[model samples]
Each structure stands twice: as C-alpha cells, then as structure tokens.
Target chain A: MTPDKLKTILLVEDDDKLGRQVRSHLTEAGFEVDWLRHGHDALAADPSQYGLIVLDLMLPGTGGMDVLKHYRGQRCDVPVLVLSAKTDAAIKVRALDLGADDYMTKPFWPGELVARVNARLRRPLANAGDSIEIGRLRLDQSARRLFVGEESVDLTRVEFDLLLALARRPGVAVERGWLAEHVLDPERDGTGRTLDVHVSRLRRKLGDRAVCLQTVWGVGYRLEPDA
Target chain B: MRLRPRLALTALLAGIPLIAGSVWARSAIERSNAVDGLTRLVLQRMLDGGRDECSRWPESWPIPSGPGMGPGMGPGMGPGMGGEGMPTWEERQTRMQAMLRGGGGPRAFSHLGPPVEFFAYSADLTSRNRLAPALHEDLRTGLLDGRKVVSRGRSNDSDSPLEIAVRMDWFDEPESPSAIVLARQVGASEFGLAREFLWGVTALVSVMLLTLLLSAGPVVGRARRLTRNVRRSATDQYATSIPVEGSDEISELALAFNAAGAQCRAHTDLLEQRERSLREFVEGTTHDVMLPLTVLQGHLTSLAKTSSGEQAATLRDAIEEAHYMTSLIQNLATTAKLEAEDAPPRRDPVDLVALCERVVARHMPVGREKGVRVEPVLPGDPVVVRGDETLLEQAVSNLVHNAVRYVDRDGRVLVVLSAESGRFSLRVLDDGPGISPDQIGHLTERRWRADDVRARHPSGSGLGLAIAKEVALRHTMELTLGTAPELGGLEADLQGALG
Candidate 1:
C-alpha cells in the first residue's frame, strides 16, 4: 500500500444516518474517508488505495458479502472491518471467516469506532526488521534482547515474547487471550496465572523502567514511549 | 392375571364339572349292566327247577312263605333267622350242604361265578342268610319299590365289594315276594379301560388349554411392545411409530396410537417453526432499534463535546442515558436468546481480564462525569475461562455499570480479577452504601430495584444484575453478592473454571 493510503479509509454503509456519523467520526479522527452507500460502489473502488476498509454487511445492490468476496478473490490484502447490526454469532463468525479483520456491532461509540480504525491501520510490528526502540528500552528482534539505558536486561523466552507483543503496538492494548495464545511457550500450560507470573518477573527485571509497561486494567499490557 | 394364566384358569374351571359328570355316568351304566346279568342268571336258574328242588330240599334255605304262613309268622324257617327255637351253627351248615346236594334237575348255583356270593330274603326280611350284610336304608327302599338296588359297599380299601339286590315273584304269587342279593369283590383292573378313557379325556383337555395359552404369547408380546413404543415415541417427540403386527384389536389400537403420534409430531413441528420465527423477529427489531440508538448516541456525544459547563454535563447525561438504552436493549436480546430452549450458550474461551477492561473503559467516562473513581485491579496476565464471549462481556459490563451508577461521587468502584488454583474469579466492589441484608436475595430478580435506587436513577432498567446472574448460571459459575469487607459497599463476585 502507498504511504498516503494509511491516512485514507473506505466506508460502505447503507443506513444514511449511521453512515454520515461514521464518516464524520473517521474524518474527525484525522482520516481521509471515501464513503459509499451501495455495495456495488464499494466493489468498483480499488481496495488497494485504502489502508482500512470499514464495510457494513447490509447494503443495496449486491450486498456487502458479495463485495467482500470480490475483494478477497482479487487478493486485496487491505484490512476489512465488518460493521453490522446483527448480533448473531454465526453472522459474525461468517464475516470473520470471509477475511474480515474486525467486527463491530451497531450502536457503537463513535470514539470506539475511531480507536478500532486506528488500531487496524497500525501495521504489525513483526515487519519492522532488526530492532525497535520505544523510550529508553530498545528491543533487538533478531538478537532477542531488551536493553534499558546502558544495561542489557535479561528476559526468559516467555518474558521476551510478552514484552515484544506489547511493544509491537506501542500505545494500543493487546488482548490477554491473544497474548496467551501467541506469546506463551507452546509446551507450557499458558494459563492466566502462569502469564501473570512471567509479567511480574519481567517487571521486576525492568526495575525503574517498568513504568513504560502499563497495564490496561481488564485488558492486557501496553508499552508507552517515555518522553 | 395375564392372558396365559387367565386362559388356563378358565379351562380348568370348566373342565372339572365335565370330568365329574362323565365319571358318574360311566359308573351308573356299568352298575346297571352288572345288575342285568345277575338278574338273568337268577331267573334262568329258577327256570331250570332249582328253586323248586331247593324249596323242599331243606328248611335252612330261604324260601317263599307257604300258603298258610304270613309275614307275621314266627321265625326259624331259615339259617340266621331269629326265633325261639333257632338251630345250632353246625346243624345249619349240615342242612345247607344237604339242601345244595339234594337239589335236582341241575346242580344248584352251577352257573354262578366263584367271585360272586348270593343270599335270599323273604319280602319281610325275616328269612335272610347269615352271610348277607344288613340292608342299607336306600337299598331297602329301592327293593320295596320293586327296583333293583345296586351299590358299591362303603370301604376305603381297594377290595371293596359291590352288591346288587332285586325283588322277584315266584310262581306268580306276588304277595309272597322274595328278594335275591349278590355281591362281588372289586379290583382296580375291573375298570382299567374306563380309567384309560378318562385319563385320555383329561390329557386332551389339558393339551387344549395349554395350546390356547401358548398361542397367546405373541399377542401379549405385541401388546407389550406397543406400550413400550408409545412411551419411547413420546420422549422423542413422536418421531417413531408403532408397528401394527396383526389384524386383531391390538393392531387397531396400534393404528390409533400411530395416528395420535403423528398429530403430536405435527404440533411439535408447528411450535418449533413459531419459535424460530419469533427469534428472527426479535433479532430484526433489535437491529432496527440499534441503528437509530447509535445515531442518537453519536449526536449526543458530539453535542456534549461541543458544549461546556452545565449544558455539557446535561448532554453527557443524555449520552449516558442513550448508552443505557442501548445496553438495555442488548441485555433483553441476550435474555431472550438464553431463554430459547434450543440454543445453548456457546463454550468459547473468554479472557475475563479483557472483558473487565473493556467494561471499565466503557463506563469510565460516566464514572468520571459522576466523579466516581472506577478502578480495575486485574492480574498481570489474562484470566481466561470457557464461556460465550459476548455473554461474559455483557455480564461484566453490567456489574461495572451498576457499580458506577450506584456509587456516590468521589466513591471508589474496584473491578478486580484474579486466578487461583485452576479457577478464575471476578469481583466488582464499590464503596457506596451497601444494600440491606433483605435486599441481597432479590438483587438478581428481574425488574427489581430498591426504593432509593428507583428515586436516584429512574432510567435504570433493573435488568443488569439479573442478566449477569443468568449468564453466570448458564456457564456453571457462581455469582454471589455481599458487603465488601474493605470497601463497605455492595460486592458482586463471580467465579468459574479456567477455559
């Protein structure tokens, strides 16, 4: 995708009121949004020009599912966030199975919609090669090491993966369920308590710099760049 | 009293009287034939002139009364006859032997069988021989009536005797009637053929009854099978029907049962179709309501963001009210989904930490606006349990929303998550005034709220905690409420197994 595409979003919604609100919210969140009311218009648009596409499942003239299928058929890898008024799990699962990245139900907060859009737009940090630097801590991806100031801190395999998972999306809170699946060692139990143990130990090792690794309450951990 | 035993009992009850009647008839005919043979023998002997020779041969012989003698004449005219000048036993024996040898024409009693014994008596019973048994009352009455009297002597032993007695007229002198008595010992072999015939009849009757009972087995079994099939079909909502086995009444009953089962199945199908349509309508209405609710929320949010001071606060309350309506609609929908008998709650792994975090985040703005400090003290890692993600999220959200709504301004609402052993627990505690002990039990009751709560938050749906309780029960978790020991407020705690 082009660098400008990261600032652009494609929104396809049929409900006039909800569609206007979503477009305005995205715009107010500093995104360039292309709003379309019909699924056919979404199908005609080049998906590659947009970094994130917010598609509503209910649309006139060829429904949203057809447009989603068409884009996925063309191998358009842009993130698609499905918006629906249906609360049925089967429909949500079907949308996710059809290559939708996220699903948001109706009556959603405008601020929440903006947050989800930005989260999707943030590129996965695995693509960042070699090293990643946030605050005084630097994560060497290849070497599998974390350095706090001049001292190189030692972390276990699970601790490094946990820290790396949070560090990937600096300010965004990662879900503990996702972290438990992706960060914990496959051979271990990977229970919540076990994950908690690793985090506490990692915090102890981080010492004064542990402030950067903030807990997002009921969510998972987040890493903030210290000024 | 099943079919087999009932048939056998009826056969037995009917067979007993028939067997008895047949036995009595056979014995009567046999006795009559024996009496006839004896009568012919005695008459033939008299025709041979043995009675005339024996009558004058000796006075020991019982004879018809002479013309001058009557029934009142003094006894001593024959042996064993009581009189004033009765003869000695030896003398009588000599006279009896002389009379039998002297009898002319044909030897007396030469035609008689050795098994038989005979005696003669005068019409008044005053001239009977010593060997004759005392006359029975029934036999005596029969002889007086001029009918032959035949009887089996009363003896329990096998060698019991049978006697036949009949009145006879001599030389046409009916007034001087004399009777002859004959007796013979009886053995079982005497009626061996009759016994065999009777045994055959009894065997045949028994076989007939047994055959009837045995044939009823399949019918009884079929009836039992129909009963079992009816019960089984009921459990499966009448998906199966009974097999009609015969053209009899049982088969007719089976046909009737099958018809009834078909009707039940049709009714069940109709009910299921109605339920599915109702679910679809509810989901459709929720979706329709959600669209407008979202727009109103968006408008209220923008209005709140643009306004300042008291106006902004009022808009914020409006936004909060809008959010409450959205949640209320969602909760009702979830309750309806849970109540549907066919749809069981999904068992997917849900992270309680993430659930609590999102809930706290959603209510944090309201908490901030209310000056309530909504804090979350979660375990450093995730606390995942097996449940439906949406339901658990909603349950936790309700708990936090209730806490934020009820807690006084500047009060603290603590949402804590912890994992111990293999189980995960969540506690939402607020430092507001705790409920009375009486109200704790009714906290989860649908549409129930305290009087004070109704006055304070009139827009509250009173369904949040109820929904949470239902979600907890469906997931096999325990949701308990009590006073928070440290926080001095209402505490809601939910605990369940790890996913």
Candidate 2:
C-alpha cells in the first residue's frame, strides 16, 4: 500500500474477534484504524477524523442500519461500507439509500476489504473531472456538455455519467453493476432496464461516433481510442 | 374392451363352437342308425315271407330282358332307378312283379311302407351283383357270420342315396347264405322333410343357448362389476372397497382386493409421513448448523489477520472449509425443501452474469488461498433467465467452488455466463486433471465421488456437483459435464431458459 498520510478508517463491528481482525488488517494497510464494538458508539463518532467507515450490518447496540441512518442524517460525508453474510437485495438497497457507500458480504478476503476501503476513500478524484473524451466524442466536465467534433449533443444525467464512467478508463471494461451504481439515482430500484435505456440514449447522443464506446465481450463497456 | 363387458361376452359366446360341432355329429349318427334299423326290418320281413312262401316259390323268375322293363310292374316302384354301378330298383321291382303275377307267394315287401331295393349274392361278392365290390364283400361277410341285424354301408346318404346291407338265412333253402344289400330310395318330399327337421334342431339349439345367456345376465354382470372394482382399487385409486354381496367367487375377489387396497394405503401413508418428517429434520438441522459455522469463520478471520504469509494462507484455507460447511447445510436444506410438497421456489427473472460474478467472488479468496486462479468472464449484457434467484446462485456457486477445490495449484477456474442460442448458460471450466469418461455419468449422483477424487480431496462432501444438478433440474434446466478442450479439465455447464 502506497502510504496516504491522511488515510484513517473507523470500523464498526459487533463481534469481538472479527472487529479486532478487521482493525488489525486496516491498520497494517497504512490506515489509522479506530475499532467500534457497538453501533451506538459508531453513530456518535465524528466523521471528520476518518476517511472511511467499514461497518458490519450485524451490530449489537444500535443495529448497523440505524447507525448508517444516524451518520447520514448528521450529513456525514465519510464513506460507509456495509458488510453482511448474505445477499439480501432489499436490505442492500435500503442500506445504500441509508447512505452506505458500498456493500461487502462477510467472509471476504482481507485484500478485498482493503481494496473496497481504498476505492471508497479514493472517490470523486477517482474520476478527477466532470467530463472526458474518447475517439470522436468529447465531454466537457464543467458544463456537463458533450461534443462530437465541435457539435454539442444533449444527454440525460444517467447517460452522461454512464459515458463518463466508461470514458474515464478508455480501454478498460466497466462492470455493468458499477456503471449503474455510479450513474443511476440511489433512491430508485435501478433495474438493468433503466441502465440499458440510458446506454442506448448515450450511444444515440454519440451519433456516428457511437462505435467508440464498444462493449467488451464477457465484461462491460470499453471506450476505444478508435472504432 | 372393459373387463366386465369382455367377461360377459366370453361367457355368452363360449358354447357356440361346441354347439355347432356337436349338431353335425349327432345328425350323422341319427342318419346312420336310421338306415341300419330300416334295412334290418325290411330284410327280416322278407326272410319271414320267404320261409312262408317256400311252398309256392318260383323256380325261374322272369329277368328284366329289356333295358329297363320286360316284365310285370310292381305296385310301389313307378320307374327304374337308373345310374351307374347298379341294376335299377325299378328293374328289380319288375322281377318281383313277374314273380308275383298270378303267383302264390306271400308278398314280403308289400307290407313295408318305404321303397327299398335288394340284391342277392350267391357266393363271391365281386362276381354277379351290380353292387359295389366293397358293399358286396361286407354283405358276404355278414351272411357267413349269421348276422341277424343289418350293417351300415360305407356309402353316406349323399353318395349312395340312403344305402344299407344285411345277411339273413333262408330256412327253406339254407344251403347257401345270400348277401343282400338294400339301397333305400327316399322320395323328394321325404328328403325335404328330413332336412327341415335337421334345420329345426339347429334353430332350437341356438334358441336354447340364447335363452341360457339371457337368464345368466345378472350373474355375468355381477362378476364383471367385481373385476372393475378390483382394477379401480389398484389403478384409479378408488377409496372405497367393493361391497360383498354373497358367498360367491365375485365376492371373494372383492374381499381380496379390499385387503390389498388397505395394505397399499397403509404403506403409502407411512412413506409420505416419513418423507415429511425427514424434510423437517433437514431444514431444522441446516438452520441449527449455520450459527456455529458463522462464528468459526469469524474466529478464522481474526486468526488470519494475526498470522503471516504461509500461516495466513493456512488460516484462509481453514476459513474456506468452514464456509463450505455452511454452504453444504444450505444445499441440504434446499434439496430437502424441494423434496417436500411445500415451499416451492419462486420464479423470477435472474441475471446470470450478475449471478455468476457473485459466485466467482465467493470462491475467489479460496482459489487464492489454494494458489488457483478463479476468473469470472461474465457477459457484458445481463443474461436473464426465469428461475429462483437463490437456486440459480447456489447452482453456479457449487460449480465454481468445486472447480477451485479440485484444481491443482496455479490452475485456472473460469466461470463464463452468457446468452447463447437463446438460452442462458453458466459454465465453470477448470484447468486440472479432467474427470475420467467412466466417472462422468455418475457425477450428479448424490455424494458420489471417484476413487482418485476422494483420495485427493478427502474432506470434500462430493455433493457439490450433485447439488448443482438438483438445482438445475428444479429450474427446469440441464446440468451437463465435459472435458474442456482448452482447459483440459472438468467443465460443468448449466443451461437454463432465457426470459
């Protein structure tokens, strides 16, 4: 791990053993780790001191969901990664709406936890711009404007974000789910249909240069330099 | 052909062949006896008359000189009965008339009502008479044996026209026994009457059979109904037993069937009850077993953090094993639930690409711990299929888990999810020693593992592929196995309907 001087994680877990293990792993990964054994203490903590919060959903004192609500209500901008043992889609959506930045199920690898925490901490600057350009298509970040060879193309919010996510890594494939997570409104169900329609609209907006955004087989979209 | 109607028909039609055959036999015997009786009576009358007329016996009777008639005509025979192999009965009647013309002999055949012709054989049968050589021999033998009774000739009524033969001794001239053969010439009207009588007998027999069948309708119907009841008890699953009406065969059959049905019902009830309890036990046990596995996994995670390098890898392996135990319980519960009549899986649109990714994610850590590479190659677009989401996940997870577990170090396990040929397919291919051809067929059997596989992964439940197969079947999909051409290892493929 390349040392980031400002990195610190507040981990909220109920299990005594799991809490210590996660704290130890995060501490070893060059992040100053603060372990909270109760959801109440996590809900009371100040988010200003931490870059990320790795919270287990099965907390003893305040319940992980309530803790998420508490911090989110207080306008806590710190990323919260909710961990559980199973994929309960309804609960996941609820947690995400309650201000969880990401979801990770239990029994996850230590490397994966660190990666998720790092990814969450590295948000916003991860894109570093409101716009991007690939091939014949260029997106103006500041004005949320798209131009294909100096001509502007109108796009919906989801369409713009979807194209931006793919354009950020021109040749790398973006996951179908990650695209939806970044683009679609967090309050909605965000079924695959909504994502598909957005992609279709975005492609149409790209016009003849739509071929630049090519779908990688067995993966997702990759914005190639040339069609 | 229902059992009842068939049985009734069998009983009614059973006697037709016997009745038809016996009628012909009885008629033949009656005809033969009638011929024998008539011939003997006529011959006896002639012999008695001959004895009485010996005092006035004509030494030389006028022979029929012309072709048909040369002498006096008798009162009975109107004309000569002419055909091959015989002096006509008419000619013989002419001779008898000539003898009786102004002659003083008692008329032997005048008292007889039927018209019959007779010929005498002096010694050898083949010598003088126009009689058939066979008939002549029969008559000669009969005479030497002093047969008082007549014998039937070999010729049937249709062939010789009612022929018979007899031998009698003449008391006045008993030196040489004469063989006499009589051919009775029945009138056309008389023949018609006899035929009418035979036809009447056939009609009467048919009528009798019909009447008997009509009277037995109730009995036959009862037997047939009993047969149907027995069949229904065994096949249609009729609930009630047949009613026993009387101490008869049908009632006895009903009793047997009723007893059999009771035994069958008891057995079925027992089996169903046992299955229900066993399903409950599995569900309860799986739920009870998951808690400890969860805590154990938590402890292992803590241990893995403290440990370094090789020890950490070993801890991760133990954690993976514990995780596998949890999955086994879940699969056992799921299969048990499927076996039960209740708790059917929900049919929903499941995204196969997303599903495969989740399964790959779960097994990636274990693969890393074991030094095998678990790679997921899910399609860019979602591969949607209509099935239970959890079940589809379980199926794919089982495949990916097995791939990671069975593959050698540095081997790659690739999970590919795609929509191909309008079906959603989730394929898990590994790069390891492939399963043998003989072992492929038994891969889906519950807890079945090859000898080498059991030796290699001794702790494996061997139910991973079996659970995958069961889940596939429940989703109305097929789980197929093969050796991947590229990977040179086991490839587990599940193809499901796309929605």
Q: Which stretches of candidate 2 lie over 4 Å from their true place?
A: A1-227, B1-114, B118-170, B173-248, B337-346, B367-382, B406-414, B429-462, B476-493
User: Model 2: DockQ against the native?
Assistant: 0.11
Candidate 1 docking class: incorrect
Tens digit of per-residue lDDT, candidate 1, span B1-499: 7777887889999998887777667756655555555566555544444355335432344332233122322223343333344455565565444433422112333222223444555566534345555766766777667665455552223245556665555523533323443333334333554577689779888888878877888878888998998899889988998888869899999899999999999999999899779777876788789889888877877777789999987987787677787777777677667757335578765677656755765676567666787766655566778877777777888888888778888988888776767987788888888888878877755442223222434465357887788788888898888998758898999988998
TM-score of 2: 0.58
RMSD, every candidate, angstroms:
8.6, 11.0
Per model, kept true contacts as a fraction are 0.26, 0.05
Listing candidates in order, what is each one's chain A TM-score? 0.73, 0.58
Candidate 2 all-Cα RMSD: 11.0
Candidate No. with top lDDT: 1
lDDT of each: 0.70, 0.63
- Estimate the TM-score for candidate 1: 0.72
Provide the lDDT at B158 for model 1.
26
